[model samples]
Target: MQLLSVNLAAPHAADYTDSAGRVTGIDKRPVPHPVLVTAPGPKGTGGSGLAGDTIGDPRHHGGDDQAVYAFAREDLDAWAAELGRELPNGVFGENLTTSGFDVNSALVGERWRVGDAEDGPLLEVSCGRIPCRTFAGWLGERGWIRRFTQRAAPGAYLRVVEPGEVRAGDRVTVVSRPEHEVTVAFWFRAVTTEPELLGRMLAAGDALPEESRERALRRGA
Candidate 1:
């Protein structure tokens, strides 16, 4: 797979009605990526860690943190054709847009080498689906959340193994790690929907990232 674009936007303020019949103004700040490092700040909204809860107030749900979305390059082109316009900025709602990669099919604990194969940060991916209403707002509908989950292409959360500059048109390759079999999607289900598999993922040890391991522990609780 290759990078289609790297995007960032300045935070802007907007108002919306809530599920609880309240109205509020949301200030969505921009960052290098859509993944949030924590629950607040530019990193808080998007930069690649966890799919923050998306259906509620973003500040409360943590603003789509660590969310990565992707579409086939061809699909993007087709979508552009139908819309009779180029895909709008932030329309894909992803920090990195990729071509020729099936991100959803990636296994949890799978590590990708995101640069020259010799020296690059190992991006270990974990989890899927950070559903929220803002996502629906981005998609122009409520059911898009369901469609996202059902499709389960919730792109993986990555941790920098060697932190280096990643640019557009970079190639992504799976550096074969034979020990783990679980994909981020599998762990997402195990931790969120199935308690049984949490221990199993932890036991897989080095195959899983430390942050993911901690989340699994919380889920098992």
Candidate 2:
């Protein structure tokens, strides 16, 4: 697989109808050059690993477990076809728009070497992105959140394992895959609609984020 584009956004005031909806940096735009990818501190830091990216709401965005967000070009294409609109690379607020990658099918704890061997970053799949009202407001689609949830293809969030520069056209190699059946799509479905599947998510072990893991365990209990 390859990185189609590297997207970043700075904090800006938005008309999003969620929780005051003031400083949301979800309107990411593609960058021409390589950008540094690193851990942006802790969970409530409200910043991203991408150099120019910003996280508006610390309470819900930006954390070590969510240092990077990636979406597949194939998925975007599907959405575009269904919505009958042009969905650009960064339109969904993803940091990396990837080609030839099945991000939704990626297993939790999967490790991907992004870029070349000479200079690249290592990223570990952590969890599926949880859709929120900001996303619906941004899209302005009627029943957008529900539609997205029903589709169950929320992109994956990743933790930076080896921080480095990443740019468009960089190669993405799956370095390792955890022996688990909990794919991002499955996890998204479990957390969003299938309460019975929450117990199954625990099988992914430490591959899941702490909060998600705890929630799954609680549900399973």
The best candidate by TM-score is: 2
TM-score of each: 0.61, 0.96
Write candidate 2's Cα lDDT for 24-73 as tens digits: 88889899999999988788754698988878887788888899999999
lDDT of 1 by residue, 138-159 (tens): 4464466666555444555554
Candidate 1 achieves a global lDDT of 0.51
Report the alpha-carbon TM-score of model 2 versus the true structure: 0.96
Best-matching candidate per lDDT: 2
Report, for all candidates in order, the number of backbone clashes.
23, 0
- List residue ranges in candidate 1 displaced over 4 A: 16-90, 117-120, 191-221
Clash pairs, candidate 2, are none
Please list the residue runs of candidate 2 whose C-alpha ends up more than 4 Å from where it truly belongs after superposition.
17-21
